[model samples]
Target chain A: MKNSFVELHARERALSLLDAKTAREIVGPLDNMISPHLEPQNIVPESDDGIVLMRGMINGNNVLVVSIEGKFQGGGIGEVSGAKIVAALEKVLEENKQGNTIYPIIVLDTGGVRLQEANYGLLSISEIQNVVIALKKYVPVIGLVPGRVGSFGGMSITASILSYLIATNKARIALNGPEVIEQEAGVREFDSSDKDLIWDTLGTKQRSKTGLVDEVVDDTVDSIKDAIVNEIKTKKDAHRTENVDFYLSLLNKLDLSKKLDIDSYNKLYQSVVATKHEVPAATAGNKEGTKSRGRLWFEKLTGIENATSSISTVLHAQKDGKEYIAIVPDSDNKFPRVREGEVGLQEGFAVASIVNKIVADDKDKTVKRPIVLVVDVPSQAYGYQEELIGIHVALGSSAAAYAKARQAGHPVIDFIPGDAVSGGFLAHGLQSNRMIALDDDSITIQAMSKASAARITQRTIAELEEATKHVPAMAYDVDNYEKLGALYKLVKGIGSWEATDENVVKIKQLINEAITSLDGDTTLHFRYQTPIAKASGRKATLAVRKLVDEEWSK
Target chain B: MEKLHFNFDTKDAISKPVHVGVVASGDLEVIFRPTDKETEVNIVTGSDGFKEVWGNVLQRFFDRYPIQADIEINDFGSTPGVVNLRLTQALEELKDEK
Candidate 1:
């Protein structure tokens, strides 16, 4: 109970780890950097937007401690909060790049993307992840889960991408929260009221035992700080998301008929011998595949109708030296949660295998193969099995692969024709340099489903829908998403289901144009630099980044 | 959400800005910025029709301290006691630094 790190607020938590008079808060509460999106929804905004960014020394090592306030909005990362993290981490990345070793430690206590800010939360989290990946090259990016609202949703996928994760027994980490799973997949799938079951599956102790979290420390401030200091001093790196082959091998060993409990999953996880997994391009088959927009577009673009692959859900092929990947639905797939084309275990690992292979193959080439992702994912598979086996890592693997591919000079593009929701979008769509979506009302694009988001945010579906009308970030349709200026281009004259020959040709030309526009630039800064992003979509984000840059130096 | 603003005439003037508290449930954040003009307290609270109660709380505090500053409070259904606590915390922050 003495100097408990988990008990302290976000600001106090940041200051506790730093030496006396050594801590300097960047974009602190005095800066008045509140979320502009909250007030319109009649929600009272916090001055720091529930994020405390501190730049100081941790045990004499230059460090940036980014703490999320669990008390405020369940530590949700919205526009200002996400921007503060991205900007601060990017600054740390810059400092580390200059041979000044500055480690970035994220005190994660978030519920991931704030459903209120919806698309912006997704965009900001992805931006934060992109910067984290870049910073890992210079210094080990450490993450700490100190209880209350443990990392979940898109941020857990980000957590899985960290160099090392240190957590107390008070914390839990998973891609989807228990309540969200219950809402999406029913109570039989996961009982939200069962606190024991929830904690047993997602607690840091189990996570540490299963390798989801690196270390489980005591609740004291000293213990948490010591773990962080030890990690920085030792430069310990977990490389959590790089094990595509191992996860693929693990997925191969999974038995689909029966329910997988926690103990059985742990045993299966340990018993697996990681073998090489090579997901080949989809080839023509006699039987028709599931007819989703992603599948339709993949078939039309690649001219491989009735596309069949070793992994049924994941289909990827090289057409004109440009690699195309899509995750489609399988009505009779072995994995039930992923039957509706959700980015589940196999889809994530298989996409990672394919993308990793593409990156490896193009390592020596002068020009890298441009990856076109046909994003039509509904949501991540929201069953207990997915969370029990750590689906965050699966999502993280693909996300990291795409980010690395882009960083390695491969132009990763998202051609969203269907749904682009939650963790599936993060793993597949959000990592790209450019995103082009069809101008169709049917294409649902947001952080979470309306039903689940309403439940989590404690608002009725009607209230949630009403809020969306005021805030574009809260909207579910792709048109509202485009308003955020996240898309590289909102392609018109084509329905989501309309992938005709001429439409395919048009899309292919747009894809080529988007790739050419990159001009060897690999950074996700393109999103911020876009006309829509600059105009209004990311106005607060731009302001937050500017303030962080100005204050980080001071 | 309701926005309430109150102005007070005060003698003592402070020249430091301090922020305290989190806008959590049943809690609020208070920010005090030094002002050359008349002292004022502005609040955006989640609970409506608390204008007179907030006035009483702030009026009581200012009667004792009479600090001249521009104070802003973002309250999320915090009781009068919590508001007084955060306001007093912000004053302590100011005095400690001074």
Candidate 2:
């Protein structure tokens, strides 16, 4: 018999997946409540705002299934729909805390944030991320990424951090949508019409190969049900420690210089795994006594002997007669996953604590010392333990602390000498008032790695390179990043990766210039005012903001 | 967006409140609450040009049921078929509840 569940809508999918006659929807359509914002935009709002929240039984176990209706606004999340999802998750968290084992199953068909609502969507996603991390402590949050409108944007980050992700063969999951990437990076980087490329990059099978997806099943409801059942029964609570060494070694072995297909990526993964078994155990702990480029720069910039403290990855220093905090990778870190400069739980908390402490110390003072971030992070450490310990909050806390520090009249500047990628960049440098980077080929900045991006967009490195020439957002080099108007200044004439005396002089001069230029200005509104941001099609964003403001005023 | 309200004379009174359908795209929901007097209907729809069609469909629904109740509908471009189906389902559910 042909299965009818494959063609079901999102609400139907939720009801079908639950135990027969057990699903009771809360805040459902009959409530006659709809989005207030949609009416202003001349859009008819759905009563439930495109989300179905049902308290039901799945395989006789109490569960909450939150399904997004992709047909409505491409399953974009606005205030009401976002609130429903958050409230449902919050309810689950509350029940779980009361010792009631309420499992959460999020059926993600969203295209991420709703651009019409803009800031509200952004805020809601952030709140959702915070709650998702909190919920994981009680039960494994299962994510079902079926096709139609596969999860993108902030939802992709949320999906990646889930305890167990089950995706259909047709499902596409990625941090950046192909169309957005194409718009930002150019057609050569990501052709929106290239179905094969999009699928190969973000399809369930590809994500499975990359270890981002836990299980890939057929599109049928039975298959999905069985996968979720199996996960609930057999999956262990996710912890980063389990996969730290593996990821660290795998990331170490990855050759980003070459165009990597799934086959090549898997080969590299296997080689790393094989070599891991052959390597001496002693070398794993030998990260001590070895100074990273960040540490070397910290020492040179500070010009103080033995100035570095014994903190995990956070380096405290005095530069140009001013105290600054620098978070760098501790290659010999006890947390193996973050040892290679990826921000993990410890690094996140450390950065937050150091910054928070600095803010607290200078609370009464009018002139807060400048905080310099020596950034070279590849990405947030991706593993089970990181998620288990709530890496989102850890990274979020650090970001919040920097924002706090900047608001408190401190000049926060980011000096990038290495890879500044993904959430690591967001947590460390993106919040700074002014950012300076060495104009070196070695310095790269973008969201996530190229291999992952190439997979998500189904393009080769050559295509990405070609697109980078036209689309500054697609480019990882500092020169292109400078074109985005995100960076305050880019210093040239740095001879090597190491901080030489002359290089330090140039950097310090630029740092002072950056600080002076800030003139106690803390808001990041300056980014929109940049000529590059205005010229490079940020007009749409500005226009939307203006429209939203106009609507709000009335 | 449009809002319409109508009150029609009916013979029977609904005993309790009942709800049906979903407010997905091209769909709607109806909630019926017990009323001792005239049957009242309230509609809020996304479609701007469908006031006359909505009136006709709702009038037909009240004609078929003839029940005294307060009816509320929140629609998102739902068609005549869906509107009738939801009204029928809501009335049927109300009868079952009684």
The numbered model that scores best in TM-score is 1
Stretches of candidate 2 above 4 Å error? A20-22, A30-33, A237-262, A269-554, B4-7, B15-19, B35-38, B95-98
DockQ values per model: 0.91, 0.27
lDDT of 2 by residue, A221-282 (tens): 88889888887787655442124345545544655454446566656655666222111101
Q: Least lDDT summed over 10 consecutive residues: which range in candidate 1 chain B?
A: B89-98
Model 1, A441-530: lDDT tens digits are: 899998888889999999999999999999999998878888888788998879988888889999999999999999989998887888
Report RMSD for candidate 1: 1.0
Over 4 Å off in model 1, which ranges?
A: none
lDDT agreement with native, every candidate? 0.91, 0.67
Return the lDDT, model 1, position B72: 89
TM-score of chain A of 2: 0.56
How high is each candidate's interface RMSD, in Å? 0.7, 2.8
